[model samples]
Target: MMMTERGMVAPVAGGSVLAQFDDVLAAAAPELVGHVQAVKFDADTGRLGVVPDASAYGTKLRWCARKLVTAANAKVQGANVRTLHVLAPAAGKAGPATAAAALDRQPAAPAGPVRTRETVSDGYCRALAAHREAMPPRLADPAIVQAVERQNRALRELSRQAFPKPDAVEDTPARLQRRRQAAATEAAALRRARAEKAGRQVAASQRLEQTA
Candidate 1:
C-alpha cells in the first residue's frame, strides 16, 4: 500500500479498486464480473484503467465504462474512479503478433489449372457433341470452336475482367451468333436515325434559304 499526496492510503497493485469493482459488478451486473481484470486508479485525473481478460469483452466493457466507474466509485470511497480505459491483453503482446507475421510471410497456395484456349474449346465441343454431332464431325465442328476460342483469347487480352478465361456465355455458338446479330441490328438502326435527322436539318435549312 502507498500513501498518495491526498494523504489517503492507496491500494497496492490496485487491490482496493479491483475489490470495489468486483463487489459492485457482483451486486449489480453479476454476468460481467470476470470480464474485467487488473483495475488501476489514477489519483491525478480520476481515470480508471482496466485490463480485460479477453479482447472480446473490451467493447462491451467500454460501452458501459462510465456507468461502471460510477458504480465502483460509489461502492468504494476514496478510489475516485472516473473515465475507464479498457486494455486488451494482446494489445502490446508479441506472441499472437509473431504468429500473424509468420502467417503473412507464408506463401499462398498455387492457383487452379488455367484452361487454355484449346482445352476450353475441346471441353465446350465435347459438351456440344454430347447433344448433337456436326457435319463431318471433325472439320465443320471446329468453326464454332475456333470462333469462340479466338474471342476468348481476344477478350482475355483486352481486360482483367476476362482474366483466367472469357465468359461462358460468349463460348456458346448460338448465343454468340444472336449477340452479333443484335449488335448489328442496333448499329443499323442508329445509322438510319442519324441519316433521317441529318436530312430533316438539311430540308429545314433549304426552306429557310428559299424564304430568304
Candidate 2:
C-alpha cells in the first residue's frame, strides 16, 4: 500500500480526482476517434462509466455500456456509475444530421458470408438516427442534401464492415489485414475506457464505496 495525497494508504493506483476525467472524451460525441468510450475498474469495484459521442448511435452505445457496467459492478468489488453529459454544438452538426436521415432509408450492402442482416439493419438505424436533433435551419439547402446523402452512404458502408461474411476468412489477405487493424484500434479504445472509469470509482464520495 502507498500513502494517498490525504496521507492515507490507498489500495489502488491512479485514483485521483484528476484521474477520474483523464480519459474523458475530448468531444461530447463519438464522431471522430469514433466508437463508445468506457471505463472499468479491475482492482476493486470494476466500477464502470462511459463517454460516447452524441448521436443516435451514441445513445445506443451508452445503453450497451451501462449494461456491461451494471454486470461488472454487481460481480466485482467496486460498484459502477456513469455521468450523462452534453457538449457544445459542433460546426458540422447539419452534415451529420442530413447524412444520418438519408442512410436510414437505404439498406446497406451485404458482406457475403460474414455479415448479418440484423447487424446491418441495426447499423443503418443507428446511422439514420445520428444527429436527429438540433440541426441548423440554414442547412436545408438542396446542395447540402446530396452531400449529406453521400456522407451517410459512407457511414453505412463502415457499419457494414462490422460483420464479415461467415467465410470472410477466405477473403484476400489485404482485406483481412485491414479488418484486423480495425479490431486492434477498437481494443485500444476499451483499454482507455477502463483506465478512466477506475479513476472515477476511486474518487466518488465516501458513502459510495467506503474505501479505507
Candidate 3:
C-alpha cells in the first residue's frame, strides 16, 4: 500500500506515482522524457495513461508501448503496468486535428481567371529570361559554378518546353556567326584582364623580395 498526496491509503503510489513513472520512462527511453506531458497509473487494471506533449509523440509512445510496459514493471515494484494508453495532448494545444479545424473555419480562397497553356508557357519564358539576365557571366567558386549551371539547365529545360521545336524559329546563319564572334571577343577581353592582374601581383612580390 502507498500513501496518496491527500494522506489516503492507496494500493499503489498515487500522486508520487507520476514522479516515479517519469523517472522510469526517462531511464528506459531518454528521448521520450521531454515529450511526455503527464503519467497516470491505475493500480486496479494496471493501465498506464501517458499524456504526450503532441499527437506525434503519442504515436511514437504507442510504437514503443511494449518496451515501456516491460521497463515500468521491472523498475517499479508492483507497478504491473500492463496496458499503455496514450491520451490526447492537453486541451488548448494546437495539433494536426486542431490545425485542420482552423483551416476549415477559414474562408475559401477567391477564384481567379483560368490559365491556359499559352499563359503558363509565357510565365515560364519570362522567368527563364529574368533568371538568365540575373546570372553572372562567370563564377570563380566551383560550388557556385555548379549551382549556377544547375539553375541554368533547369531554366533551359523549362524554356524548351515553352518553345517547342515546331513552333520555334531558328536563328539565321549571319546572326549565329555574329553571336559566336561576340562571345570570342568577350573571352579574349577576360583573358587580357586576368593576365594584367597576374603581372601586377608578380611585380609587387618581386619588389617586396628586393626590399627584404
Candidate 4:
C-alpha cells in the first residue's frame, strides 16, 4: 500500500481490518460513529464505504474525508483509503441488521437521582413526615405548642448558622449611580485620548508643510 504525509493512498486488507478501522474512526471522530450506521471497506480497491444513518451525515462524511483518512492512517499500520463512498441502504434495510434489531429492543428504564438517608436534607424531610406521627392527636395542647415553638427556634437558628448574613448589598440606585460615574469617566478619558491623537497628527502635518 502507498502512503503519503496526507495519509495512506493504497488499498488495505487483513483479518483485523474492520476492528482496526472502527477503533481508528472512533479515535479520529467520535461523533461520526453515531452518524454512521455501518462501514464497508474494500481493501483490494482502496475504497472505504460508509452507510450513514441519515442523508445529511452522508454528505458530512464526504466533506471531511481528508481529515478522516489522515487520522485513520496515522493510527493503523497499513490503511490505504483512497476514496470515501457514502452508501445508501435499500428500503427498510439501513446498514447492518444488528443495529436495527438493537433499536427495536426496548432498553430498561435508567436509574434516577438517588437520595441517601444520611443527607441532612433527607433527614430533615423524613423528620417532618414523622413529626405528626410522633405527636399523636391525643397529646396535650400545651405540649404540642411547646414542641412547635422549639422546632421553630431550632429552624431559625439553623437558618442563621447555615447562611450567615451577607455584607449589606449596595442598593440599585447607588449601584446605578456608580456605574454611570464610571462610564462618564471612561468616556472623558476616551475623548481626551482622541484629542491628544488629533493634536499630534496636526503637529506632524504642520512640520511636513514647513519642511516642504
Candidate 5:
C-alpha cells in the first residue's frame, strides 16, 4: 500500500478499507492509467476479473485510485498524532492507564439484544432481513431489502445516525460460491424487469418516429 501523500490529513485517522475495484488492480502497476475498468466479483461463481481498459475514463480512474491510496494512508497517520498529546496524570500521578486497568478488571455484565417485544420499528426488522442468510421464499421477499433500507434511512435521520454504506465485505471463496448460486436465482427476475422497461421505451420511441 502507498504511504500518505504530502499535505494530506485524515478526519477519523486509521481504519482498514478498500475502494470498489481500482486498488485491487493498480497495486501492481502504480503508473497504470485509468481505473480498474469493468471489474466484476461474482461470489457464487467464484469470479474476480477486470477489464482494465480505461481509455475513455483514464483521467477519472487515475484520479480516483490516487485518492483512495491517499485516504487509507492518512488514517494511519492520524492515530500517531493522537498519542503525542497524551498528558501524564499529574504531580501525585494517578495515571489514567491505571484507572482504565481497574475498570477492565471488574466483571463484565452480560449483554443481550434489545427487546422490541411487539414494538419493533420497521427499520430494525428490515435490517435483519437485508443481512439474512437465506431470504424468505415469497413475493414479499423481493422488495423487503429495499423497503427496509428506505425505512432505515428515514429512521437514521430521526435518530441522527448515518445511513449504512453498501456492502464492504469481500466474499470468501465459499460465500462467493453460494452467492453465485443465489445470484442465478435472482437473474431471471432482473432480466424480466429490464426487458419490460426496454420494451415500453422502444414502443414510445417508435411511435414518435412514425409520426415524424
Candidate 6:
C-alpha cells in the first residue's frame, strides 16, 4: 500500500478506488474520520484492512463494518471489498538491542506520587460532579441523563468504599423523596438563572435599538 496525498494508505493497483471509498466512508460515518489511521485493500483476498488510531476506534469500526463494506463496494465500481479487517497499530522496528541501547542512553522516568483510596474517591467524585454540571442544559435526553446518573452513582459507591461509615443509614423512602425535592429545586433555580440572563440580553438589545 502507498500513501495518498491525503496521507491515507491505498493499494497500488486501485489507489483511486480506495480513495473514493475513503471519501464515501467519511461521508457515511463522519465521526470515524480522524480515528481511522489507514485503509488498505487486498484485491486477491477481497479484504479491506482498516487501521484505527486507537483500540477504542477499532471497536467502533468493527460495529459499523457491514455498513462500511456496502458503502465501499457501491463507491468503488468492480472493487469488491467484501470483508473489513480492523488492523492494530504497526509494531515499531526497535529490536532488543536497540531497546537496551536506548534505555542505557535515556535517564529513568521519575515515579509518580501514590494515590490513596481517600484521594482517589475525592478526585473521582469531584470530577464526576463537575462533568454533570458542565453538560449543556439542552442535552436533556433520557439516555444522556441516565448515563450521567450512572456515573454519579458509580463515583458515590467508590467514595463510600473509601470511607465506609458504620453509622451510615440506608436511603429510606423519605430520604429518597427529600433528595428528589432538592434536585427539583436546583433544576428550577438553574432555569430561573437562564431565563434572567435571556431577559437581560433582550433588554440590552432593546436599549441599543432605542439609542439607534
lDDT for model 6, please: 0.69
Kindly give the stretch of ten consecutive residues in candidate 2 with the minimal lDDT sum: 82-91
Error of 3 at 192 (Å): 99
Per residue, candidate 3 scores C-alpha lDDT tens digits across 15-127 of 44555766777867778775674445676677776677677777888998898888877776656678887775644553445434443443565489667655667688899
TM-score (C-alpha) between model 5 and the true structure: 0.16
Better of 3 and 5 by lDDT: 3
lDDT of 5 by residue, 63-176 (tens): 454453443335333323211111112222223344334334434654876566777888988898887857755566658889999999998787654544458546699998
User: lDDT tens digits, residues 33-136, model 2?
Assistant: 33433332223333333333456545564554544434333333322233322222223432334333433433565568665555666676777777565455
- Give the TM-score (vs. native) of candidate 4: 0.35
Q: How does residue 176 of candidate 3 score in lDDT?
A: 98
- Which residue pairs clash within candidate 1? none
| lDDT at 68, model 4 | 73
Residue-level lDDT for 150 in candidate 3: 100
Give the count of colliding residue pairs in each prediction: 0, 16, 0, 0, 5, 0
Judge candidate 1 against the unseen true structure and give its global Cα lDDT, from 0 to 1: 0.66
TM-score-better candidate, 2 vs 5? 2
10 residues in a row with least lDDT, candidate 5:
81-90
TM-score of each: 0.37, 0.20, 0.37, 0.35, 0.16, 0.35
lDDT of 4 by residue, 137-209 (tens): 7756898899999999999999888887767444598889999999999999999999999999999999999
lDDT of 1 by residue, 43-118 (tens): 6676766665556666777777777877877777777766886654433332434324433443465489766655
Q: Once superposed on the true structure, which residue ranges of model 2 sit more than 4 Å away at CA?
A: 1-34, 39-49, 74-76, 79-212
| Alpha-carbon runs more than 4 Å astray in model 6 | 1-13, 90-212
Taking every candidate in turn, the Cα RMSD to the unseen true structure, in Å, is: 21.3, 41.9, 26.2, 22.7, 37.0, 32.2
